[model samples]
Target: MKRLTITTLLAVALLSGCSSKEEVIPDVPPSNLYATAQTALQSGNWTSAIEQLEALDSRYPFGAYSDQVQLDLIYAYYKSDDLALGEATIERFLRLNPDHPQADWVVYMRGLTHMAQDRSFMHDMFNINRFDRDPTPSRQAFTDFKYLLERYPESEYGADAKARMIFLKNRLANYDLATADFYVRREAWIAAINRCQQVQRLYPDTEAARESLKLEKTAYEKLNLQKEVERTEKMMKLNPAK
Candidate 1:
C-alpha cells in the first residue's frame, strides 16, 4: 500500500508537470489575423497589433499579405516606441525586398526612426538644447534622407524628407559650433578654427553661419593670423546678427 501510494503521487506529479508546459497556440485564419492586426493599428493599440502581425507572419510566412504584414509591423514597432525593433524591421524589409514598390516609403520611415530616437521628450516638450547631445543619430538620419531624395526624387515623401534634411543640417551645424566654442574656451585655436570652417563649408546659410564666422575670427586672432582674422571679421560684420 505504501509503494502504491508513492507511485500514485509520482504519476500525479508527472501529469502536473506536463500540464504546466506552455500550450501550443492554435492556428488562426490568416485573413482574420491580418484584419485583427489592422483594426488594432487603427485603434492605436500598438502592442496588440504587433502580436497579431507576428502571429500572421509566423503562420503564413509566404501568404499574399506577407509583405504588407512586414511593413505594418515596422510601423507598429515605431508607434509602440520600440525603435530598435523598428530599425531592425526596416533593415530586414530593405534586404528582403530592395526593389519593392514601396521601398522609398520604408527608407523615409527609417530616417524618421533615427530622428525620433535622437530626440528626447524633454527636447520636444521643453525645447531643451540638443547641441551637447550625441550627433550620430542625427547624422544617420541626414544620410538616410539624402539617400531617399537622391534615389527616389519623385517619391511622395521627397518634399517632407527635404525639409527634415534641412532641419537636421542646421542642428548638425549648431553642434559643430558648440564644439568650436568649447575649443575656443580651451584656447585650442586651431581646432576651433577647423570646426568653424567645417560648419561654414557643410552647412551654409544656416543660423550657425554667424556663430561660425565669429568663432573663426576669434580663433584666427588668437593664432595671430591677421589676414584670416580680417577676412572672418569682415564676414561677421556683414551679418546682421553679429
Candidate 2:
C-alpha cells in the first residue's frame, strides 16, 4: 500500500508539472502583448504575430484594440495563406460590426482573399492553363467585389474592385469558351454553340464574347445551318477579336 501511494503521488506531480509548462501565454499587460504582435507583424513573422494577437484579443476583447486586433489577425491569416481562418474572421467581423466605418475596406479584403485563393501555384510554375480548374474562387471574388461597388460606390476601393470585376468577367467567359472549344473538337456542334451563346449572353462586352462569335460561326457551319452561320459572321465583324 505504501509503495502504491508513493507511485500515485509521483505521477500526480509529473502531470502537474506538464500542465504548468503548457501555459505559454505571458502574464503581461495587454498593451505589451499588442506591441509584441505589432513587432512580429512588422518583421513578417506571421505565426508569432497570430499567437500574440490572439492572446490580446481573448484577454481584452472590449479593450481599445479589439477592432484593430480582428483586422490585423485577418491580414495575418492572409499573409500566412491560412485562407479558411481568414474568411471566417472576415465573416465574424462583418456580422458583429456591420456598420463599422472600415466595413468597405474589410469587404475589399475579402474579395482580395478570394482572388488570392483562385490563383493556382502549379499552373503558374508549369505554364499550364488555370482557367481549366474550378473557378469557384473567382466566382466568389467577383460577387464580393460587385457587392462592394453596390454598397459603397464612393469607397476608395471602388475603382480597383471594378477593374478586378472586369478581369473576373473575362476569366469566366474564357472558361466557357474553352469548354466550347472542347465540344467543337469532339464534333458536338450544338454543345459548342450553347456554350458560345452563354458567353455572348452573359459577358457580351468581354473580349471572350468576341471570341465566342468565332466559335459560334464554326459550330453553325458544322451543323449545316447556313443562315445562322451568316448571322454569327456579321456579329464577328461587328466585334472583331483583338
Candidate 3:
C-alpha cells in the first residue's frame, strides 16, 4: 500500500510540474497557428481563424510562410466582417507584394467591396437604401470592373463584372437624368440644363439622355427660350436616328 501511495504521489507531482511549465511557456508556434487558422477558415470559423492568425503579427517576420500568413489574414479580416481593416490590409499587401501571384485577387476583392456598398440616388429621398449619396463607391466599382474587363477578360469573374458594368452604366445614366428632372420640377432651369448636358457628355448612348433631351426642349420652351430650344431642335434633327 505504501509503495502504491508513493507511486501515485510521484505521478501527481510530475503532472503538476508539467502543467506549471506549460502555463509559463508560449505554446503556439507561428506555423502551428497558421495551420490551425487555415483549418478554421476552411470550416467557416472566420472569427476564430482571424484570432489565431492575428497573433502571429510580430513573430515569424522573415519566412515565406509569413507572407502567406499575411495574405490569409487579409482574407480573414474580410470574411470576419471587418471590411475597413481588410481593405487597409489589402492595400498594404498590394504595395508590399505587387508582384505576388494573388495580387489580382486582392484588387478584385476590393472592387467587390465597392460594388456591394454602392447605392442609388433616391435611397435617402425615398428611404430606399443605404449609401444613397455616395456615387463614389459605384464609380470605383465600375472602374475596377472595367480594368478587369480590359486586361483580364478571360478571368473567371470577368464575365460577371462586365455584366455589372453594363447595369451600373445604365443606372448611373438614369441617376443623372433623375437629377435633371428634379431640378426641372423645382424650376431650376440652369441646373436642369447643366445636368442634362452632363448626361449627354457622360452617357450619350443611354435612353436616359434621349429622354433628358426631350424634357430639356420642353423646359426651354416653357421659359420662352427661343435660341436654346432652336439649337436643341437643330441638334436632334442632325442626329435623327438618336
lDDT of 2 at 130: 61
Residue 51 CA displacement from its true place in model 3, Å: 1.7
Q: Put down candidate 1 lDDT per residue, 90-146, tens digits, no spaces.
A: 999999999999999999999999998888888889988869788999999999999
Model 1 Cα shift for residue 136 (angstroms): 1.1
> What overall lDDT goes with each candidate model?
0.90, 0.91, 0.76
By lDDT, is 1 or 3 better?
1
Clashes of 3: 0
Model 2 pairs in collision? none
Q: Which ten residues in a row have the lowest lDDT in candidate 3?
A: 128-137
C-alpha positional error of residue 211 in candidate 3 after TM-score superposition, expressed in Å: 3.7
TM-score of each: 0.87, 0.87, 0.71
Candidate 1 wrongly placed segments (more than 4 Å):
1-26
Model 1 residue 171 CA deviation (Å) reads 0.9
